[model samples]
Target: MSGLIALLDDVAAISKVAAASIDDVAGQAVKASAKAAGAVIDDAAVTPKYVNGFDASRELPIVMRIARGSIFNKVVILLPIALLLSAFAPWLISPLLMIGGAYLCFEGAEKVWHALNPGDGHDSEAHIQGEGGGVSLEESRVAGAVKTDFILSAEIMTIALSAIPVADPLWMKALILLVVAVLITAAVYGFVALVVKADDFGLGLARRGGGMAALGRGIVRFMPGFMKVLTIVGTAAMVWVGGNIVIHGMHELGMHQPYQWIKDTAAAAALAVPQVAGLVNWAVTAFFDGIFGIILGFILIPIATKVINPLIGALRGLFGKTEKAGH
Candidate 1:
């Protein structure tokens, strides 16, 4: 009987330990996902464009396809690469991170460049409008979105990998990253599905419901504006996060002036706003980070378009394959 009691107590302890481990995994996953929120938001923002011209009935299907592709991208492809990097070439992590950061900077800056100049090539935009030949336009868009997701997912996994606590075993890190990969992909795509279907949902509610029908009508009216606002927010987030990564990467690589200036400037701005100091600090910091990103992005646009593009073209030309430009 005493032995039986001891066994029960041991089982209880094991159960407790298991529960704690699960809790720890969940907590770590949430924290790591937060670190990669920028990439996540960009992923969400970039996805909707893929289904833009498709029929409403096809929207969810396209999103699901993209989501499946995203899962394959993160879990099957990027996750292994990430783990291999962690194990074998941990030294490559920082450089790869910087490369992703620079790409983000370039993308954010290109948006600003377009807003400022407005007279760029239309061939790029034509793909979004479903103008490509032969293959179903939907397939092209899905392929393009999946390609874009690959870049953003690479960044997301890297950022999540960096946030992982080094004390944890490589297996633990892998588990956390797996959780993050599933969670972020679900979240970004889920939100995207909601965004793409908001109008339909609202219309259905407005038509089929009762007392809240007026509210549904209001929602139906407001969704367009909300989408636009979300787009702006997503863009700002991209710049802020991208700028931040590059700034922090520079610090990691031993350059500190830009980081110091951004910090001091944000601190001063916060000091000036005594009543909303916290909000002021956050706003100031984001503002400066975004501004820095915009400037860096603008500087890179010409280099990317003229030099990098041509160099890439030449390389591909030498290899007898045409290099495609990023959309």
Candidate 2:
């Protein structure tokens, strides 16, 4: 009897420990996901645009395809790479993050440029379609969205990896990141699904009469303006997060002038407004960071379009010819 009781007690203790570990992993995953919120917002905001011209029935399917690609990007591709980086090339994380950040800045700035100069023949989606216009367009959009997601997913995974403590065990780090990846992808895509189908949802509601009809009409009327606001917010987030990442990466690399300056300025602003110190600090920091991102993005635009893009195209052409010859 005594031996059985002891065995049961040991089992119970192990169960308790297991439960606690699960809770800790969940908590850490949530925190890590929160840290990657900027990227998450961008993901959500950018995805709906891909479904814009598609038939209403096809919208959900398209979003699902992109979401699946996003999961593959985060889980199959990025997760293992993130784990490997954590295990071996940890120092490479910051530079890679800065590269992702620069891309974000470029994307955000390009949008801004287009917004400012509407009709300026910017080659945004020219390569997305071919001879078979409709089918090719859809496939190309999905591919483009997936390609964009890969960069954002890389940033998110790296940010999550950085959020985990250095003292954590390898398995624990992997588990936490896995949780973060799954949870963030689900939340982002779920929200995107809702955003894209909201008009249809509203129309369904509008068909049903009474107060619901009014509400439905409001939703239908409101979505366009809401989408505009979401786009603007997403753009600002991209610039702010991108700039902040680069500045912090510079700090990590030991060149911390602007970062230190931003920190000091934010702190001073916080001190000036103690009641809303946190909000003030964040707003001030984001403002300067956005300014820096805009400047960097503008500087890179010409270089990227003229030099980097041409080089990439030439390389792709070379690979295409080589593969054809081999075939």
Candidate 3:
């Protein structure tokens, strides 16, 4: 009887420790996921456009496919790579993060430039109406979305990895990142599914003819403006997060002038309005970060479009020719 009681007590203690570990993992996952908000928001905002012209019935399926790809990207591809980096070349993380940040700034700045110069016609109606069969178009869109998701997923995983403590056990870090990956993927794609189907839901409601119908009609009317607002917010987030990353990376790399200047300016602003000092400081910091991001983005745009893009295209072309010749 004494032996059995001791065994039971041991089991109980083990269970308590397991439960506590699980709780800790969950808490850390949420905190780490929050750090990647910029990438997450951009993922959510950009995904809906992929399903925009698709058939209503296909929207959810398309989202599911992309979500699956995203999960694979995060778990099978990015997770292992992230772990290897954490274990070995940890110093590479900050530079890679800065590269990702620069990409974000370039993307956001390109959008802003396009918005200002709508005559560029890069995303004009004609581009959408290009000669392609519906199935092919769908495939192309899905592939494009998946490719974009891979970049955003890399950013998210890196940011999450960075947020984890260096002293954590490998298993704990893996568990925290895995949880973050699953939760973020579900949140982003789930929200995307809702956004894509909302119009259909609204249309159905509008057809029913009642108070519900009016509400449905209102939804239909609201979605366009809502999407525009979402895009603007996402772009702003990308710039802000990107700029912040680069600034911090610079500080880490021992060039502290920009970061110190921004800090001093924010501190000065905060002192001027001590009542809402924290809020003022954050806003001022974000504003300057966003401006820096915009400027960096603009600088990168021409290089990316003129040099990087052409080089990539040539490489792809050469690879395609090599495969053809081999066959």
Per-model lDDT: 0.83, 0.88, 0.91
Give per-residue CA lDDT, model 2, range 201-273, as digits (tens): 8998999987899889989999999999998998898888888888988999999979999999999999999
Ranking 1 against 2 by TM-score, winner: 2
> What's each prediction's clash count?
0, 0, 0
lDDT-superior candidate, 1 or 2: 2
Per-prediction TM-score? 0.89, 0.94, 0.94
For model 3 the TM-score comes to 0.94
Q: Write the per-residue lDDT of candidate 1 for residues 10-102, one digit (tens) a residue.
A: 999999988988898889999989978777877777678788767798999989999999999999999999999888898788888877877
- After superposition, the stretches of candidate 3 with alpha carbons farther than 4 Å from their true spots are 121-131
Model 1 misplaced stretches (Cα beyond 4 Å): 122-126, 132-135, 205-213, 268-277, 321-327
RMSD (CA, Å), candidate 2 to true, equals 1.8
Residue-wise C-alpha lDDT for candidate 3, range 1-327, written one tens digit per residue: 999999999999999999999998998899999989989998998889888777898999999999999999999999999999999999999999999999889888988988999889554123333347588988887788888899999999999999999888899999999999999999999999999998999999999998799999999999999999999999999999999999999999999978999999999999999999999999999999999999999999889878998999999999999999999
Model 1 clash pairs are none
Which should have the higher TM-score, number 1 or number 3?
3
